[model samples]
Target chain A: EDKVVQSPLSLVVHEGDTVTLNCSYEVTNFRSLLWYKQEKKAPTFLFMLTSSGIEKKSGRLSSILDKKELFSILNITATQTGDSAIYLCAVELFDNNAGNMLTFGGGTRLMVKP
Target chain B: DAGVTQSPTHLIKTRGQHVTLRCSPISGHKSVSWYQQVLGQGPQFIFQYYEKEERGRGNFPDRFSARQFPNYSSELNVNALLLGDSALYLCASSFGAAGVYNSPLHFGNGTRLTVT
Candidate 1:
């Protein structure tokens, strides 16, 4: 079975603080890793990482994947109150018979205080 | 353009009852997927449909069935619901087939089902 695990299930940080979330996966035929932020009901897309070493960034948020190590990390340079949400990590896998599917981690709940 | 849209933001059911959830994919999107998310847990993949064909399915039981229409809309039906079936059901859509690289899914707000 494909599995994705996230570390530090929950975190509390203040404004301007930087935080890093970790995700590791064990699967066959790795296709890509994606990050999302859920505030209320829907989860918004953040980044999709496919290659190792190269980091994908958007404003204060950034992520990097290490295929060899089977892990990825999402970094928030300066957090704000609005940044409080559940951070989700999902791994996409492709199988010749099963086609493609995504498996998600439990997610890390982040509470950013103003 | 509207994103993925699901019907009945909330629902209440009892054991042995049947429920049908509806989803309309984004305009021009050809792929739609369904997921179930329990409180405090990650969403679990239930089914994926593209071009009106079943592409992939998770480990859910036969009681959980789904079908896609020619317009790319989809419906998920669960029969004989149990207490454990209560969860948030999410619908996601993508422009291309799920296997396509770099394709990200756009999710709907989700339907919260509470089985009493």
Candidate 2:
């Protein structure tokens, strides 16, 4: 069965502190992995990593995929209160569903205190 | 683009009742997928449709069903709703179906359903 797992279910850190979140997955025909920031109702896209291109960055946030180890990590540098939210990792497989079918991890709840 | 849109931001229903949640994908997007998210948990895939055809389905029960229209709009219907069925339903859209591995899914705000 395909599954995605995240480490450190929850974390609390003071603002400006750096944090690292982890995700690992086991799936067939793994095509890509995606990261999302869900502050409230909907999740906003953060990055999509593939075997050929395993790293992505945006501002203070960055992510890397290790397909050989079947894991990925998201790093937040100089975190702010606005960065407090659930960080989700999902893996997509080659399927008849446009790769839209994703297996998501439980997610890591990040709390940044000011 | 307006992004994905879902109806009834919030809803209240009782066990054994039925509920229908609606969604409209972004213009030109041909794929739509539904997900159920319980509080404190990541969203779970329920169904996926493209060009009015059922493309994929998750590990949900038969009581949970959905259909996509020619216009790329979709509706998720849950029958005999149980207390456990209460959750937020999320709608996501993509530009294509099958083999479009790089297409990212754009999501709607989601519909929160509370079953009493």
Candidate 3:
């Protein structure tokens, strides 16, 4: 079965600090890795990494994938209380018939305190 | 454009009852996927539909089924709902099935189902 594992199930940090969330996976025909931020309801998209070693960045959040290691990391710099949310990592893989489906990790809950 | 939209923000059901949840993808998007998220967990894939055809299904039981309409809207139906089935049903949309490599999924607020 395809599995995605995330480390440090929970974390607490002060505002302006940086945090790194990790995700590793084992799947067939991996295509891409995606990151999302979920607060109380739906999750919003963050970054999608299709290439290794290359980083995708937004304002304060960034992510990179390591295809060889089957892992990805999301980094948030200058974090604020608004950045507090459950960070999710998911891997998209092709099925036997070449169709795609996403397998998600357990997710890491982050708390940014002021 | 409105991102993805789901119906009935919250619902309460009893065990053995059936429930139907609806979703409308963003305008111009043709692919729709369903997922279930229990509290304190990541979303689990349920099904994916493209152009109103079933493209993929996940490890969910037969009790969980979904269909896409000609308009690209979708509905998720769960029969004999159990307490364990209570979760937030999420619907995501993408532009297409094949070229989804770099596309980020747009999600709905989700329908929160509580099975009593």
Best candidate per TM-score, number?
A: 1
Error of 3 at A94 (Å): 1.1
Q: Cα lDDT of all candidates, in order?
A: 0.92, 0.89, 0.90
Residue pairs with colliding backbones in model 1 are: none
lDDT of 3 at B23: 98
Q: Give lDDT tens digits, candidate 2, residues B34-84.
A: 999999889999998988988888888899999998898999999999999
Query: Residue by residue across A1-114, what tens digits does model 3's lDDT show?
Result: 889999889999999999999999999888888898999888899988888999998998889999999999999999999999999999888886426888889999999999
B37-58 per-residue lDDT for model 1 (tens digits): 9999999989999899999888
Interface RMSD of 3: 2.4
Winner by lDDT between candidate 3 and candidate 1: 1
Best-performing candidate as measured by DockQ: 1
DockQ, all models = 0.68, 0.52, 0.60
Query: Which residue segments of model 3 deviate by more than 4 Å?
Result: none
Instruction: Calculate each model's fnat, 2 decimals.
Output: 0.60, 0.47, 0.55
lDDT for each residue of candidate 3 in B1-116, tens digit (9 for 90 to 100): 78999999999999999999999999999999999999988999899999999998888899999999999999999999999998999999988872276566888999999999
Which regions of candidate 1 deviate over 4 angstroms?
A96-98
Could you tell which candidate, 1 or 3, scores higher by DockQ?
A: 1
Please give, for residues A1-114, the per-residue lDDT of candidate 1 as tens digits. Answer: 789999889999999999999999999989999999999998889998888999999999999999999999999988999999999999988755446878899999999998
- Residue B78's C-alpha lDDT in candidate 3? 99
**Docking category of candidate 2:** medium
